[model samples]
Target chain A: MDTTSYNNPEQGNQEERLWNYIDGTATATEKTLIEKLIESNAEWKEKYRELLEVNQLLQASELEAPSMRFSKNVMEEISRVHIAPATKSYINKKIIWGLGFFFITMFIGFLIYGIGQMTFTGGEESTLTKNISKVDFSKFFNNTWVNAFMMINVVVGLFLLDMFLSNKRKEFRKQA
Target chain B: MSTGLNDNEIISKVLSGDHQAYAIIVNRYQNYVFTLTLRMIKSREDAEEVAQDVFIKAYKYLADFRGASKFTTWLYTIVNNTCITFLRKKRLDIQSLDNEHVFATADNIDSGMRANIVEQKSKLAMVNDAIGLLGSDDAQIITLFYKAEQSLEEIAEILGLETNTAKVRLHRARTRLKEKMETHYTEEVKNIYN
Candidate 1:
């Protein structure tokens, strides 16, 4: 509350020096000077005590801790990124295998359906020759019921195979 | 405090992909980081999320740490920056000493011990509300110096200010807090007398 000591040229400098000392920010010589001042002046001592009390109170206020999950969540996030690269290559390989299996199954089903159609007709050799000559082989293989049945079987079989493959993929993924 | 392996050793290990070494750094400063974040963010959920992000970012950029300062200082810098970013993105109002005056007057009738537990809780809520009224920089400096127990020099380093500047800011913040407290006490006294 006394501004004179902090404003007068000589006492003002000492007051500032004393403040730094009390705050633990003074250099060695300044600290020694302030110590001497405290020894000589009763007022400085009282000011020192008051400053310390304020500092202590400020320090006493507890700091709340952040959530307990902080460390775990951080580590988990970092590891998630780290593990991604390793699994990315595996995912790429799976995509290639899936595409290969899809095309191979389609080729096999086409061959099987073509052979079934050729065999169903009575003039087997002649039908085959005609089938080779006509691009529109549906005229010779115009049995709609048989064609429809074979198409249905092909779709059902592919569906079952897809389910089986997907199951296997899941198992493989789990193992990996 | 002198472990054979220094922060540099631990950081080098982390950069070489030895992630477990990171736990050492986290364990060392997690409390300080968490406390600072919690005080600033005010929500446990957001504080935890931000604190976690701070550490993870520190780890990712461990290589960028040139040993220009103490490891803890560097960590504080990151935490401070992260909290500021979060505050900005969320567009939270920076409360100043102005709000404390309002709180003090509004809750004047509920001062005595007879005010009950709920009233006590409201008092604390008002105090926190006052804190929330401080400007972002003021609130941060108050928390860093008072709550975190960081020296002015350490705070200066974290906030990238000169020591004198930090001291001035600290003085201003303390003055503001004291004023707010005085206003609250005066209001309560008036209500009691009335």
Candidate 2:
């Protein structure tokens, strides 16, 4: 219950450190520090002994395994189930990133293709140039109806995307 | 442990159409899985049925396992989730963890009801009943740590918690168990060991 030496300003919580040591998750330095504390601090030692008693009681009794046919029964059930081939379908971060990369790459490819095929012809045919040498801003943005449709579709598309991502997350959790 | 065949290999074999290979997986995990379901459902017959369904479910979902952790961890997750789902389907009276508060407030509980509860249970059975009375988190950590002999890291993986958090939870769980034992088995614990 004493809070004085219980804290290590740099290391973190002393109670958590003591627990980590007991659970075998502590670092070497922490183990040494906890050991020293246990040896020198009566309260720490008592705490350790008290927890160890609880651990002993917990480990003392375990629930019994099922009947002898447990494995056979399990096997029977397994036999009944059709073993499908291992699926590469476990949705994970890497797969989602890969899919994103594929879509981005495809979009870039399609953009390049569209640009390559664009032609400006008056009398003589002229291939499309990456740099636009015309002012078409009025045509693109001057139409109120077109602009309104574009804006609405963008908003609706974003809403759809959000819904899609949310549903995918839920599916991932339920399957995972 | 079966002929040096790891779970991954057995899984691979099963996936490769060696359907019988799943038997190895089943045998390897049967006891531990059975004990877990039994503790959750508190009935051998129901536990057996749930345990079988769990295995069948595991086989069906084996393809979904990407081996992110140990096989036991994945299998136990399925076992735990399946048991929880089964409990939901049955709609047992123990639907909420808070109901155990009734046991905690022993003096408020009817003597007849408590007596009816303890009538057939032996000391060990009483111990198990006390554990069942623990909230799911505490009961699960105690089982995974002590009964399953899982390390703190494994328990964390099982519960999807950070290691430090799992350690704290395990400590708190032990404290709760101690309180439960002291409350319910104050006489029995002393008598059984003496």
**Top-scoring candidate (TM-score):** 2
Work out the TM-score per prediction: 0.56, 0.62
* After superposition, candidate 2 runs with Cα above 4 Å error: A1-17, A89-176, B1-4, B91-129, B187-194
Q: Model 2, B1-194: lDDT tens per residue?
A: 35488888888887877878787877777777887777677778998888888888889888877777678888878877887888888886443365355555875778888777666667557656677777766777778777877877677767667667988787666656656766666666555434
DockQ of 2: 0.26
- Clash list (residue pairs), candidate 1: B95-B132, B95-B133, B95-B134, B95-B135, B96-B133, B96-B134
> Model 2, A1-176: lDDT tens per residue?
22232234432254556656777778899899889999999867866765565556566765667788877777776666775655665457798789767755765565454445544333343434533554234554555655565575578568779889977865674486
How far residue A59's Cα lies from its native spot in candidate 2, in Å, is 3.1
The numbered model that scores best in DockQ is 2
Clashes of 1: 6
- Across B150-180, the per-residue lDDT of candidate 1 in tens digits comes to 7787898799786689987776565454444
For model 1 chain B, the run of ten residues with the poorest summed lDDT: B185-194
- Residue A31 alpha-carbon offset, candidate 2, angstroms: 2.9
Q: Candidate 1 at B192: error in angstroms?
A: 22
- Candidate 1: true interface contacts recovered: 0.27
Report clash pairs, candidate 2.
Answer: none
